[model samples]
Target chain A: MALVDDNLTAAGVAMEGEVSDYLALLKPRVMSLVVFTAAAGLLVAPGPIHPFVAAIAILCIAVGAGASGALNMWYDADIDAIMSRTRNRPIPSGRLDRQTALMFGLVLSVFSVALLGLAANWFAAGLLAFTIFFYAVIYTMWLKRATPQNIVIGGAAGAFPPMVGWAAVTGNISLDSVVLFLIIFLWTPPHFWALALYKQSDYAAAGIPMMPNVAGERSTRNQILVYAILLSLASLLPLATGLTGWVYAVPAIGLGLVFSGLAFKLWRAPAEQMKRNARELFTFSLLYLFALFLALVADVGIARFLEMIS
Target chain B: MTAPTEPEMLSKEDSDKLAKSRRGRSIALALVLGALAIVFYALTIVKMGPGVFNRPL
Candidate 1:
């Protein structure tokens, strides 16, 4: 009887992971942003791609981003359990076990990369694979715990999707794609530092060494302002490179000013009001990136339409 | 050391829930596989064009 009971348990007769639990592991909110940005990259590229191929590239990028999220969740489950913001994630919440999450992430990562190679060019596929590795191994395992500059460098993983999308269409990186990469890369520091400001206690408890907890809030706020200024300037590179016209340029400049303005307010905010200001900046940063990318796509579409009519 | 004890068995309700979860996962997996097949078939058709069917054996 004991032997039979052990066999059933070994066969996962007690497994309780639901579909939603698996989905939550993917960090769908982040995946949505990745999908939007990747699609923007694909749409704004110089040459045309079959609609079907473009769809596949976007799907692969989304899945690859989700896979990395799962792997991050698996590795960070311990810290996640300690941090209030992450305490309810699948692994930390006990909705799914670590091994199950790890296996799921690995399987999805492999399938997404392989399918992307088969569907798109291998260069794009290679970029997807590197993005996954950088997120799972470098950011999650090493830099996240090792440095206060975690998100500063770890931001590269999140920034790669748009470049991968561009490569999927062009089969090579270009100055335009690099500009897109720079925009997000610069945006990450201010964006995450804002969140870190409000969630300082959580990182402290988790021993994660986020910028706000490691550097004083004053210093962190200073850094955020600097990055915001740099991001504002980088957002205009599309115009300099002729990738976008005043349509994108106007909105990019407007959004960047607002982003910088918020960061400036957050910097000068009194200690008593710091958290509120940080929260405000964090919320607007999301809209800023989304709007900036949307403006780029619209600008490119308008340009192409006018050329076609002429 | 004492002999190892028998593993605890799940209650009927818990067993039913587990079974349902497993079924849901299976269905999700099946749908994903089906979608993959459609993507591959469409890609092959798009890449090769109508001439794909006329290729010499």
Candidate 2:
């Protein structure tokens, strides 16, 4: 009877691992943010990129993001199976073999970068290639399991799409493009640290050295507030630098305030407040960045079109 | 979805099926990638110069 029971449990575990592996492929949340940010950058860049190129650029960015996700999954499969939150991932669940994921990631990484370059310019393609390397090699393989500051430096990989988009159109980078990159770079720590605070146990169980896992919740909360304030300041840079007008400025200031407000609330709340507040901050932080980027796109689109005619 | 009940990787016939599935996926992947590249090249590079789409309409 014990033998049968053991066999059943083993089979059940295998099935769960399989499903999580596929979910790891989709990397749905990451894809959502990448697509939107890349599209906004393309729309607002100084020149007209064919709509088709714009679509492809976004697709390539998404594929690159997925590639990074797959690589992360492949590397972290062992730990993922240990954590409750990640146990359902494909590799962890044993639905998809790690070898299959590694092949998929490599193919997508090569395909997306090579194709982006051919479609746009070597520069954009190069950026995509570097992004894949940054996330998969530097961030995933090196940083993520090593240090608490992993997301801070690693976040730049996520921040590259807008620059890639600008390069797609302009064939060069600009200060405005850099500003977009900065916005995301600064925003990432607070956004992720919130999740870290809420999911420290998952990180602890997985043996991943996420900041909150290494630092106690008190220290992590302090870090979130500090980063949040820094992010708010960075968010306002578009106006101070004159990269954007009040069309972007007004909302940037307003949204920055609310984002900071939430961060502080998260900081001050009791340990129990950590989960709910962190989730709220995570969800709202996404909206904040999206709105900011959309505002910039709208301003640039309207203003540039007016210039072309007048 | 339930994976196959077989514990072994594949018998000769099953290997054939696996090969076909993989080939199908690869071909489909190639076609999709090709189509996507074509679309991007047309928009990003071909129609990408100054005033390329600046018509007043």
Q: Identify the leading candidate in terms of lDDT.
A: 1
- Alpha carbon deviation, residue A199, candidate 2 (Å): 1.1
What range of 10 consecutive residues in model 1 chain B has the weakest lDDT sum?
Answer: B6-15
Report per-candidate DockQ.
0.56, 0.11
- Candidate 1 wrong stretches, greater than 4 Å: A1-15, B1-4
For candidate 2, the per-residue lDDT at A274 reads 76
What TM-score do all the candidates reach, one by one?
0.96, 0.82
Predicted candidate 2 versus true structure: per-residue lDDT over A1-310, tens digit per residue: 3453333333433332323345467588888889889888777777666666677777888888888889888888888899888887777766777787888799889988887887677888888889889988999899988899999999999999888888888888888889889999989999898888778888888778888778877888888899888888988777776767767877888898999999999989987777899999988988998998988887776677778899
Model 2's chain B yields a TM-score of 0.62
The segments of candidate 2 whose C-alpha lies over 4 angstroms from its true place after superposition are A1-24, A308-310, B1-57
Q: How would you encode candidate 1's per-residue C-alpha lDDT over A150-236 as one tens digit per residue? A: 998999999999999999999999999999999999999999999999999999999999998888999999999999999999999
Compared with the true structure, model 1 gives a TM-score of: 0.96
Top model by DockQ, which number?
A: 1
